[model samples]
Target: MPSTQFSLNIRTQPSREPALPCHETSEQARELVRGTSLELYSDGALHGRTAMVAVEDPLRITVSGLEDIILSRTPGDDEHLIAGHLFSLGLIRTPADILGLAFPDNDPGHAVVRLRTTKPRRSLGPLPGGPRIDPEGIFRLRERFEQRQRLYRSTRATHAAALFKADGELLAYGEDVSRHCAFDKAVGLALENRLLAGVEIAMLTSRLASDLAAKAAMARIPVLCGFSAATSAGMELAERRGITLIGRIGRDSFTIYANGRRLDV
Candidate 1:
């Protein structure tokens, strides 16, 4: 009798002391892929192989012991990411609401944000109108967004979100293994810079879903475009929120599922 052995292994970046949460961290920590040694089964032959794998890290966010959420995302921009997520949930209004962020026990997996205002969410009204965007501007934004996808280019395992002004100026950007987290990071970056009110448009890769629509609604972003198709729920949310929703973005064509007022048409 013989037994087959199975093993699992993963590789990570070199260990270093994570940044103290008292201050903002550098964007250099955006490396989110690794060269992994793995078993390859091809053409009826099993062999060893080396491949690029996405880095998925767990981040526990606690808001002064009031609210908590664990996000499975890439390993960077931890502070902004959490702030954006909290804001989208209507837990915090602006960056000033967060007094500070810290890593508990110096553990990167856990983060705590001391909040100055922890009021429950108020009514979520529809987004504002005006500040429409031209199609040409969307194309240019896509060009810039593609250039910033360092992790997705290597591992093809991450989604991205970018916030821009009505005139096509980029406000903030985020890329992560989780689509929701990516969008949160973008919003968080904007919040940190006090530009949340200026984010008139946002673009995200992958399928457009209701959750994203809700986040956009909560953040009051006027326009949202997704690279792939939008779910029915997403379209409904956009319509209700008065947000222009563009989906299935292609080289020269895209579909607007709802609220086309923000597009030149």
Candidate 2:
């Protein structure tokens, strides 16, 4: 992936506040990828180093006491992951449909979502009208999205997803070992905060795959931008779902694969 040149004013200052406490202790350790230390030889010199990698673990999701599916994630934001997963899969229309989310006391890797309704899942339909975004606004949103990727900056092994308004205000951001998980986390955060009622845009550090495009469509986001290319299936889905898919985001340029009318050049 191309390096992001975007910088935020907050980046210059050290964060004085301690990291937020996590409810699950095991989750913290799982975020750190472990591997044997290795020695590097360069320019006739040898140096030993330990590197931090992104972690991936399987999470089993169950709905109403029934096994649904399993996902590999980076361990944190399990609740958001479940919420986003359900929404993207078209299992629930809104957050109110979710009665409660729980993790097993003995197994943090297992999550169950209790729903108020047992409706059959459906595919995402066409989205409502969203605010028109210009090329400059897309660039700014991507820059802000990249700036919020703290974990990726540290490990360089994580993917990020950010929710932004068409006008370029960032709503929420998520980073995880898997691109899908990252997108789900961001969507989950927005849903919890009731921030997805309005038409929004989703920016990702990963490629615009069909799955991610479908997630954005299901979430009712009208625009999806990525730092990389979009798959053919993704473009087709975006076109059918009324989503404007923008990919290959450069510093000041981007390619619109679908719904270009929403993007003012």
Candidate 3:
């Protein structure tokens, strides 16, 4: 796989101790480089009880106008973060739409993208209004989720995101400790390969919140499912954007938060 490189002049600050409820000693904040390494933790009894630690900076991606969103949890190429974000928002539809992404030689935070199509104007139709969700697609989405959670078994520390076609073909998958990173990576993969148009469903391992629902709505995905719960604000956004927000997914059931017609049986 080809890689894109960019550099950051990050300043490491002293780790401040977090406040504790009743405990006397707050765990000392550990200091380390922010983005260069993964912090691995142990899993069980005696050893797990110990503070097994490593140092690294939390990963973050800043869009030109959007505030800098932190991408901690899972780690990988940052470019994927941007690409995956675009895919979920429905901006890039086909392989030819996203030409390529380049981080200029000296600019670290800015990325210049070659679009497959002329950048369309931002005016979007009214929030996709309709029934809450179609039943069949919602059920199938719940089933596909089991296969996706296997990634969590490996890192226990990473969040996963997957993009699916309407019929449920898995198009792209990404994992990061940060839900934002996970989605970004997934979108990046689609844009890099021009596969967004083929995507109809997105499953994220994060809470279905306003920002997330907004992104999926912007990407034009019809439905989004999450392993975690959805906030009231997220439900509102999904309703307004015409995106179906499904959460509390299990092997047999799931909750449909908005735009049911898209999930119509």
- Strongest candidate by lDDT: 1
lDDT of each: 0.78, 0.75, 0.59
Q: Please provide, for model 2 over 1-265, each residue's C-alpha lDDT reduced to its tens digit, 9 standing for 90 to 100.
A: 2222221111122244311112332232233444446788998999997766666789988787456789988876776777787778767666667765655674767766678676657765686576778788777777777778877876788999988887777788888889999999888778766787654788898899898888887788899989999999999999999999999999878889998887665
| Residue 159, model 1, lDDT | 96
Q: What number of clashing residue pairs does each candidate have, in the order they appear?
A: 0, 0, 26
For model 1, residues 1-265, the per-residue Cα lDDT tens digits are: 1211212111122224222125422223334667788899999999997878887878888776574788898887777788788888787886657666766566667777777767768636787665867887778888888999977887789999999888888999998899999999899878867788888889999687999998988888889998999999999988888889998888888898998877775
TM-score of each: 0.84, 0.82, 0.62
Residue ranges of candidate 3 with Cα displaced over 4 Å: 1-73, 86-123, 127-143, 148-151
**Model 1 lowest lDDT segment of ten:** 2-11
The TM-score between candidate 1 and the true structure equals 0.84
TM-score of candidate 2 on Cα atoms, chains taken together: 0.82
